[model samples]
Target: MKKYLIVGCGFSGAVVAEQLTKNENCKILVIDERSHIGGNCYSERDPNTNVMVHKYGPHIFNTSNKKVWDYINQFCEMMPFVNRVKTVYDGQIFSMPINLHTINQFFNKNFNPKEAEEFIEKQADKSISEPKNFEEQALKFIGKDLYQAFFYGYTKKQWGCEPKDLPASILKRLPVRFNYEDNYYSNIYQGIPRNGYTEIFRKMLSHPNIEIKLQTKFNESFNIDNFEHIYYTGPIDAFFNYKYGRLGYRTVYFERGEEIGDFQGNAVINYAEENVPYTRVHEHKHFTPWENHEKTIYFKEFSKETGNNDEPYYPKRLEEDLYKLELYLKEVEELKRYTFLGRLATYRYLNMDQVIEEALKIINE
Candidate 1:
């Protein structure tokens, strides 16, 4: 039988292993530095409240792809979920994604969809025909007042840099609506697994041909001669031992607390003001609304530069980082026996759906 070695037991690694076991007569060995199978998406019930807590903050599985939705549904039941995120600005609560309701509330004016659109158009900067950076893109789309109130402080904290310093493509994913649709994601399929995310991983990796080893870190010295091919889903820079330079990344840490009844009364609430140390607060109970719990557990999320000990959450793909990535890609092209996939391996800020799509596509290739 053909043999293969896969590093990192996250979605990328799991999806590949699950598909390869069915497609080929092969024995696959999967290893991860962490003791968990789900990686950052790992979730378990809190002993205190019996609520499913997302260990690495909130992750709502949302995707427009039908194939991905059907594939994920095979493992676990996805509970219907709509993420209606709210933001606290200047002691006032506002609907997120700057919808029609948000615009009226922010300006203290009752305007219909058409009126709101016209007003925002006037507010937007007319001088700049094209936007060069994140700040300019916001100013062009929503104007300075709304951008300053909604995006400025929160973005500065989340990215750990001025909005102008970031690329314009970074802000393109966010949608601005003219209607009262408060669903945070515009995707057709969106939900949280009925069982925790970890359970889904357990089901995906249960094939007899797949052998998993947790807490086994891969390095340059690891033998590769036994396997036909090696699939690496870890950080690209780490694979080469930082031969070029360490890529830039932002990591997040959480402060946890428990409440008697309800904490935030919502899944997530962003603190838009700069004075607030944490970017957003998440109530774990709200994620799985179908489940009942007397006591509630919440986490305050704080974002900062990736430290040596921190697990890199968001990739900081500035000009310097992209330049470093180009050098790494050149090195990747020369290798024949290795395949790199997923967000960390490719060094792109990707959503969960995108990651799964890439994994499915890579395996077929």
Candidate 2:
């Protein structure tokens, strides 16, 4: 029987382990530095309020891929969810994605879809035929007022830099809907696991052929020669001992608190002003609307440049970082008996669905 070592018991590792177990001849050993599974998506019930809280941060499972959705559904019952995010600017709350309702409310006009589109086209910076950075992209897309109100401050705070310094590709991910749709994501399948993400991992890794070891960190000490293959879901730079300079990443710090009643009616609220220290606030109870909770638990998210010891959340793929990532890829290609999987391994920002889809592809290949 071939023995395999998988690092990080998150969705990537867990899914790969589950898929590999079908072979029956493969024995899998999964490890994570954290005490729990699900990696950043780890969720636990709050002792004070008994509300299910995302330990690292909020994670909503939204994917258009039926295979990916169906695969996760096998482990836990996914309750229907649609993230309707709001933005607070100048003391006024507005719908996200610059929808028709948001456009009408922001300018105090009852313009329809055609009129709104024409108005925004005029607002856009036509002079910039090609956008080089995030600021240029926003100026060309939504114009000054909408960009400053919704994206400028939030982007600056989230990336810990001015919008102009970041790539325009980042802003392209956020769509501008002309209709009244306030649902944050457009995916066909969207929901949260009723039993929490940790439960999903528990059920996925329940195979008799797999063994899980929590609080175990992957390092140089591990005998790579022992396992037939190794699947690493950790930072690629860290795996190579940072032979090349560290790839840039942004980390988040959460300020958690419990409240008697609903703190924020919505699950997520963006603070779109540079003066505001935190980027967004998340209400845990709102995540699982299927269940009722007397008290609510929330988190105020703050973003910072990832430090050596800090847990990396988002990859900062600037020009220099991409250059470093290329060097790491070269190193990865030279290595044998190893495969890098997941967002951290690939050094790219990926949502929950994308991560699972990629892991499934890797195992299937």
lDDT per residue, candidate 2, 266-302, as tens digits? Answer: 9999999999999999999999888899988899999
Global Cα lDDT for candidate 1? 0.93
Model 1 per-residue lDDT tens digits across residues 108-195: 9999999999999999999878889999999999899999999999999999889999999888755789999999999899999998
What ranges in model 2 sit over 4 Å off?
none
Clashes of each: 0, 0
Model 2: per-residue Cα lDDT at residue 82: 91
Query: Model 1 TM-score?
Result: 0.99
* Number of colliding residue pairs in model 1: 0
Model 1 stretches astray by more than 4 angstroms: none
